[model samples]
Target: MDTAERTLIDPTHFREVMGHYPTGVAVVTGVVDGEPVGMVVGTFSSVSMDPPLVAFMPQVGSRTWDRLTLAPALCVNVLAHDQLELCRTMAVPRPDKFDGVDWVPSTLGAPVLTDAVAHVHCRQQSVVEAGDHWIVLCAVEGMEVTRPATPLLFFQGGYGGFSPAGMAAKADAELITAVRLGDRARPQVERLASRLECEAAALVAISPDELTTAVSAYGGSATMVEPLGQRVPLIPPIGEAYVAGAAPEVVERWLAKVGPNEPGLVECYRSRLAAVAERGVALSMVGPGARSDYQRLHEALAEYASGELTPARERAVRTVLAQTRHFFDELDVLPDETYDVGAVVVPVHGPDGRVAMVLRITQLPAGMPGRVVNGWIEELRTAAGCVERDLVGRGAQQASDYRDWWEADFPM
Candidate 1:
């Protein structure tokens, strides 16, 4: 053999070494020989969601790949944490990988592991050569999640599960050894918690055995706090080791104590909500205790803030508020318990064009010199650069149209 040729590793040996790096496991299932057939793979990944597509790699000379390409439809089943053994069984040289495996035929006649966390059915699209593997692209036509389970993880040539959020997931070797040194690091953790507005940062429990697992695998250390009156686990959500969402005033306070980085602070606030949204956050409500009703109020106001509250949404909000007001109005209280409420449209222009009108609802602080109208006018002037009467007619029409949609969809 030539010297250069001898130095190059064989595909088999290279694959074995690459296996050490670890990857998520998935099962690519399709109809073969008039029956469902499948192979385990770790290279499956999403390609796109618009017009939906998915892709995975199959070894170039794989007979399974050849069979899969002939099928009309395929199912990619993302394995759960306990499916590592199934993946290993399918990886070996075997004629019947599904002989004793638990699976069910999907609607498309593709094998779907009964315990898979999620399964997506797709039509075969195309295949392209990529190094020593054939990249198989498929158009996802149908999908289902039969089970909800944390995923399996492969790393360092072995299988493992993920730990809960926080330091357990990403702490390095130095942090581990430092923990063994004891209470010396407690102050730092407390400082971190105080700064983060979250408790339980100091006594993080992690070990070498814990590092091999995947994300959200193990829970954090058991620690006690006075407010809770009991010992609780402290596992911060992922990436919170750096910073989290805070009010501008809170951020200013943190900077005063710990100093600040201009770029990092900007990125922290920008990325916090953006990342959470990506992770499928449904609802978020922020404000003071009394205004906890802000979410509903905001929705109602947002409808009209553009000067277009559909008559239906506006009417619904108005009806609800009216009912509450009627009940409160009937009840006897000190100083006659007078309440002032109203809405105004103030135009705001930035470097761009007209942005929005600042909407405010103020409960008057009794015995004041000025009437409620004065407060409303002062608020509108400060909230927006320009006050426009045009808002009333334009918003009323839009609100009427919106009311039509709400009436049709939501009968209440």
Candidate 2:
């Protein structure tokens, strides 16, 4: 912690360590000589409330800072997550940084960038010389929160956005509640379970890591038991229906984290995903072998859910799941010999066209004829379509209700 010890830590090491802290991105803009001038700064901070003060640090060598400091007032425009390109435009040295950029003048005549999350208009207050940078302080004269949006974040030498954990938890809860309170789909899934004499379950994507069984109707003879709220890893066979229609980047991220690097396995997964997309459903054979594997997997997952597994065991189970990718391939492809027990999953799309939930039927009896299996598949697809249509209808109704309320409240 001494100066000499600190000096021993190289600049690269210091930067890498400090990069763990996330900061918001903002652009300091002003009007000088009847032209728009701006520069990006990542170190903007609020200093005081009573006096209404704000501060930002600019590198002493920045030519833009030299010109910006001459202006009588400055406007700090906090960038939104969608304004990354604007940040880049003001980052490098350029003669006309405002070229093709949209802006308007604030009360103090400082350029306020359009679509910014907020703007703080301030008058020049003071400056202090900090090592290799100038700490420019300003007195806030006016401010406005232009819009509500996700703030752009800078961390670990990259740009990102924030999603509150509480919001995600609330969203998950709402999705579960929706599944349970469904008038159209929940009853349909129950009827399907009764007709097929198999367990029919609804699975929702709770997070990128796992899917939660929101609701299930047991057919009394289901060999496997997936209770309500049971969470399972977003792995194949169990989660292929959700993954099949997910965004490419999302699928890639999931694979990079948990998928094996073997090319053959990757190719197999690709083919399975392609087939799921083409056929609009996912199928998995649940013979005696698969049932045993699933039973053990379910036990391990339950232990994980209860936080009873040690770190080593958790890792071991994850590895096992990744290595068993081959077991989930071409599940819909019927074998030369008929096998008892299989699962057919159909995805239910939400208002955004993303797969919000899946309807799955498990534990088909052995010696079932091909025609019967095909019939089951068609029936599952029809059920999924019904659920999707119902969800869309509900979403449209809610939107219309909101519009009516807004019109009544505003009377304009």
Candidate 3:
């Protein structure tokens, strides 16, 4: 290849190629003339560790940069995965952009976003001229990771968050569809949580082997609630409500993962699944004096969710989940058995009659009688019905297409 034969690089091609790389989002803030000023930048990076220098590129004629450079000091606030809205506001050039932003001044009088993943206080050291941009350098004064969380990322012209590769895996297309289903069920879920005085949630099957709590509401004296997007294993007994009505392959895949092939263990879960489908509601009973056992199960699930479990540790967690079979052996409870209900779940159907999502209630008042438990399940079923009607009215299908978005096919 000869330099004389090379074609000039176009700006469009340059940006499009670079956009394939992910960048951390940051908001540079400072006090200028008694007012807080900020600008969002994707070009924030460390220049050198020896002198503690940082650099960010701004358009050559950016008025926001011109104003910020006048300030005595600047604070670069690295955003967390949950701060997308905040990033949008800071990206615009407006005097009142900081109207509702929460922040405090650093020792050098630079504003630091209170909830940012980190803050770096620095003073302008130099600026270099780059084509169509200016590379502004700063001598770092102080920096710390204020909130240790996954940093917000910008990739391919959109914002997204990070997931650990070794942990809970999520397919992008499947996740998009799951989120869509959950959004449609939010109104009913919120209503149910308020009416039942417990934690209510909508779980979507983001993958064949797992369901994620997409929408969750904690209402009425609720002390514990599973975090939204919490992945729940679809393994036997733990999620019988979901598997009871799943497709044949899905059901088979779920059953094969049973922890122990005890003589009748597989058959036991099969019977429970059939019961769940027949009963229209699945109940988990934590009979009196089983709180510690339930607690152990909850701890194991939490450990699994952390995405840092070793292979042996994950097996231990699966074993813990498997041992909870007694709780789901609840198709016919005698009136004499006082029930400490753990969770109640009901399936929400789509327009196509497939189970799109399941409405679940947990953190209920323990030591409840079977009659009271029945009433709660009845209320949950009613809510699920309302959500189903809403989905049908809106013409939502069992599975909506998101391949174009996740597959990167844009027709502009």
lDDT of each: 0.47, 0.74, 0.81
Question: Taking the candidates one at a time, how many backbone clashes does each contain?
Answer: 16, 0, 0
Mind giving the per-residue lDDT tens digits that candidate 1 earns over 1-412?
A: 5567667788789878887776888888887787667888888989998979999999999987877788888999988887888888777757677888888788888888888879999987888997779888899988986775557777766777655321123335423332332222233334333432232222121221111111010113322222211111111111121112322332333333222435554454345434532321111212234243433443443432232222344445444332222211111112433332211212222222222111222222323223443443444344232212322333334323332432353232
lDDT, candidate 3, 31-77, per-residue tens: 99999999999999999999899999989899999999899999999
Give the true-structure RMSD of model 1: 20.7
Candidate 3 ranges with C-alpha deviation above 4 Å: 1-168, 171-173, 333-337, 402-412
Q: Per-residue lDDT tens digits of candidate 2, residues 241-263?
A: 87888767546645555455666
State residue 108's C-alpha deviation in candidate 1, in Å: 1.4
Regions of model 2 farther than 4 Å from truth:
1-184, 288-290, 307-309, 331-337, 395-412
Q: Estimate each model's TM-score.
A: 0.42, 0.51, 0.56
Ranking by TM-score: 3, 2, 1
Candidate 3 residue pairs in clash (backbone atoms < 3 Å): none
